[model samples]
Target: MARPGPRPARDHGRRSQPRPAPRPRGRRRRAPHVRERAVPALAHEGEVPSLARRRLSRLSRGVPARLRGPRLLRRALSRDDRRPCARPEAQARLRGRGEGSRLRGAEADEVGLVLGSTQDRHRGGLVSGIRLERTGALVTARFDKARGNAIDEPFTQELLQVAKELGADPGVRGVLLASAHPKLFSPGLDLVTLIEYDRAAMERFMRLFAQAVWALYALPKPVVAAINGHAVAGGCILALTADYRILRRGGVQVGLNEVKVGVPLPWSVALLLRASVPPTALTSVALLGRNFADDEAIAVGLADQLADADGFEDFGRARLEEFADKDTDSIAITKGYLRDAVLREMRARESEEMDAWLERWFSDGTRERIRQIVAGMGKGR
Candidate 1:
């Protein structure tokens, strides 16, 4: 009777190892609606090319919020409320918006410092993107995307901004233009903009971009381009803008390719290259449209130094610091003086001239040639 009452009590106290907690069934995150839909505003006072506006519009879409990339997000968010040449209130808004926004996210890890700002004191956007450093020297980020880093206007603007920061910052002694993109410098300009946008917009775009280039060239600090990979067309032009060009020994192919596009070089772009490399030496690179290997580029003065991709950053930084360590006062003053004449020419050039340049370049003849070449290469045009 006692046994029946007890009924072989189960060992409840045995306390089997606690069953593992159930795994969470994650819910999909809902994308927030655009709450504060501010019209895309210019981040700075200088002109933003219409081409850039259009390109940015397209780029802003499609890109995943998380994948928007730190540098680009900073550039977009750092925009000033004022359109260039806008009313004072607009300018003030822009000043307030400044590079502060760009410094907010994950991508910030890539940037070295904020160099350009609306106010003269901090002018931060000029150097607001990535600034990879090893030791005290500065380094550029290599290209990390596929389809390559297109040398579209936005990409060009990014380069210009970096240069502007370098010019503005008295403290930034040196910089390197390294690609995180594979086989990268850039593919070329957006053929779509060349063909689709009206001529006037193209001219406006050039003017804004030219001014930015001028700002970069005038930077007192030494700028080194570490070509981690290929540099085509606009990409080549960007690399040439640096004071010293270093290419990875076996992995680079670089040159200005306007001729291949059947387009004459924009005057301002031509002038930039001329200022950096000797005219005679640049002929084949610019006109023949042949992409030279690292050795050939160095032979023609397209590159000042060469190294394997592994050591390129280290070597470039050493060179940059060498120049950075110089008397910066002299450096800044001399750069300004050297660039004065060019700036005068750029300022004197007509907006119409730039428009005409784009018109002729994008006319039927050039368009067909570009189409043919792009088709031949089997890459999306």
Candidate 2:
């Protein structure tokens, strides 16, 4: 009472008197259809990785369908942010909603610059997960992300979506899947976060991962992997999906180490391994779960060719070009002949494999192992 209860809150009436409405000019403002895309548009600025992931979560719920269309996207882009905003040509792509069907998250800016517009522009902004650039008839998807390009939900989802787009586009003659990191292709799955996944969560991720890999494997076009860095565990499986893999022979660790970490390889991964690795070397490659060196990876058929440190990109491009010059239809048919079997086998055994995988993933011993690994990860990065 002596303090007067903090001076009592001031009450502002909704309308103290009849206020004049907003003066209408010659033209009426279209209000804001852009509000629907407000969340994603705000996410476009150089957002932190944690914030980016949250924005992507919203997109997964179908925010992309509300992509602000031409009106909203153009309106949003018109404002000069003093940064490298979307150019007119780029704006048209986003406006028409024709940049490969659906653009992921707020990649609206990056998509325009990276779609073979210019090299200098592409180098300026690094998008999360995968970055696709079309040079000539080949489309190169560089796997670049923060914290060593971990295989999270965003990674797999973007990959699958891009695969679908490239597969549908007739102009894309060949595809190159590589890592943007100079010395680390990918650290594989985000096991730190994944350690907390229950059976259902694990199943969902595994399912999406399988679809992404399958899309890459069955793309009906020549796909090459430039393994210029460490491709471990899940990363190794990604490389195995490609029709040909060119590995940089020095300072790179590559292989499947799923067993060592307590999770068994799922059916889809098994198919990819079987298709890529030589039958004689499958046991050592899949069972031992150790990183294969340059020569060993090649000998085991994990890699088709070897490239020097500087020539990694060229090495991949040359292979893709060689394939592109051929009769594409015949090439696709032959690839189908080899990999279609794997797809069939993977589909047939998907259920049982997932069942077994989930059982092992949630086991008491595995949880402890995962927890220990996750704990160690925080200390390093």
Candidate 3:
């Protein structure tokens, strides 16, 4: 019927498809040139796209529209308008423009100014037979003698000098005495040296030894002893000079053992023991020459407190700080009043006492006893 619906159309060789609609022309797609240039510039500036976005967010909060772009940021960083940050290397790199652009130089100058004003504040250094360190108002002197920190002629002289220097230093508010040895604060006098000494040598040694202890005892500032190890004989006498003595607990022994070694106690040594040890225990502590452990020492008033070995110095420091508020001049005056009699007695009797000690030391019985003691020490070692 439609029989020839118009014989309408003749067959076409291919079917046609509809075309896509044209994009709106309002903004005209961004040119490829713009995208390519922008991406590479950001890449060259060592900023990742995400980081750049974050920076842009931060900049947008306060930057004017005219200064909001990456071009302005780059220009500002390149010019020396602001500090180049705290990084030294970065500042160094940026300082190539001229010496005036060196930020670190200014910082160094400020630092030098501060250091110059204080000199070597809080500095630490060494002296023979001891190490001295300064921290704030506290100064510490550590005994480091070669022979168990034994009181030898040289050791005594050095210690005496150090004590005098620290006593005279206005900057040092307090002094802490300690031993560098782990097991022996000091084993007393160097017997080997003593055995070799003649009357003159022994006299000189004893005089200086007395002076050394007196220096510490009379020191204007407070002195604290950190007895981290054995303090026997003369070592105990040394500790007794301190305002406070803190003993390390566990296996450490302290006392005047002169009688046990067949050596009679010096007059000064006897006085020190009488002053520090309880009067009731003085006979057993000094006469019997018995050694006491930390607890016993504390019980007998030979030590102020018992501290763990690791914390001895800290304990001593705390003890010193207890007097931090006391006027140093007042303390010196009071201590002088309390100790003047003892010091005077020692000074008055030193010559005669030392002569008698030298005579006893060279006696056949005492010399024989000392030889045995040295032999025993050698065997123990």
Candidate 4:
């Protein structure tokens, strides 16, 4: 009876449950590479990357392949490219490659932007790198100088001349100040250029700069600054002179950063700021001299509108036209009244202000800082 074979399994009185099979621990799956996750179609098919794909590759270059998941891949393909890369080194590397702030040629017109092609249409090279284009009642003054449209003698003179020309022309109902290059407006004074100037030369240019800014500030027409790029120091002052400012939405900064560089705002410049920014933000904006992105700039009243960089120029033109279509007579008169006090203060204290600015400009500490800044920027004369 008991053949002593295997015991008949001890089933005491309960039914036994079957054990599940163990999961095979194959080599831990490596996260998919960015190319695979971002563009599976192209990756599997083994085709060359297009501009968009190149941008994606660059966006994920330094990131670990494991971290380049589907979420990050989506961001790489979408509007977030307007933001900076996750890695600082990657950003600097991109800049060194002359790509200019993650601007890719995925779209049609952006091809031209990435190619660094000049706008040949309606371009009048009136002042070397500066261009003046007149279309109907709109006059566009574009600064396109070397070194981010540096504020040198020719630049100051061109601005002053353009302001005068627009003020006198009865048919000109609006003016739009712009930059030929989309990503760089102006970096204020040409420190390297100015560092070589003798005292007389420096004073003369500074005086001319004041006159230019005053002329721009006092212009009666609907003046709109279409800033598609970085605008700091003198550039910010130039923007403030406008009745309204439209700045490119992302990856650009605008500020009156004179204090950071050991310079004070000239009287005319200070007046422009006081009128443009709100009283609540005045002290912080003027005294701190901090750079602000598009949203922050609009919030502080430094920038009036935010525009996408893709068609920023056209958008600015349409916006300027909107303002220009208003009642020219009443708008002119009202603007004059609003600006009268600023003009009075400017005229009364121009001499004293110039003297103070010159004194500070030539001070030992300021000069040393200026030299250091120039050296750092590798813009030495």
C-alpha lDDT score of every prediction, in listed order: 0.59, 0.71, 0.69, 0.72
Instruction: Give residue 352's error in model 4 in angstroms.
Output: 1.3
Per-residue lDDT for 1-381 in model 3, tens only? 445443333348554555699867553432323323434333322322232233335544544444445563432221211122223334455565665343234443332111100011132211136655444567667786676787787678767877787778786788888887899989999897688888788888888999998888878888889999999888999999998888998978988888876767888877777777779998889788888986788888778888886666778887887775588888888889888888888788877888777777888888998988878878887
True-structure lDDT of candidate 3: 0.69
State the TM-score for model 2: 0.71
> Candidate 1 lDDT (Cα, whole model)?
0.59
Native RMSD of candidate 2 (Å): 13.6
How well is each residue in 78-177 modelled by candidate 2, as lDDT tens digits?
Answer: 1221123343455566576653343444454344334421111122221336656655567788886766778887667777877887888787899998
Per-model TM against the reference: 0.62, 0.71, 0.66, 0.66
Superposed on all Cα atoms, model 3 deviates from the true structure by an RMSD in Å of 26.9
lDDT of 1 by residue, 145-221 (tens): 23465544444565566556545655456666676565676666656444455666666567666765666566666
Best by lDDT: 4
lDDT of 1 at 191: 61
Q: Write the per-residue lDDT of candidate 4 for residues 1-381, one digit (tens) a residue.
A: 857775343467765665689868655454545455445432212322233354456666666656776565544432222222222333444565554334332321222111111111233222334555555577777787788788887678767866886788797899888997767788889898898888899989988998998899889899999998999888888888999899899768999888877778988888778878889888778898888986899989989889997888889989998989999888799999999998889888888878788888898898999999999898544
The numbered model that scores best in TM-score is 2
Comparison by TM-score, 2 against 3, better one: 2
Candidate 4 residue pairs that clash: none
Judged by whole-model lDDT over C-alpha atoms, candidate 4 comes out at: 0.72
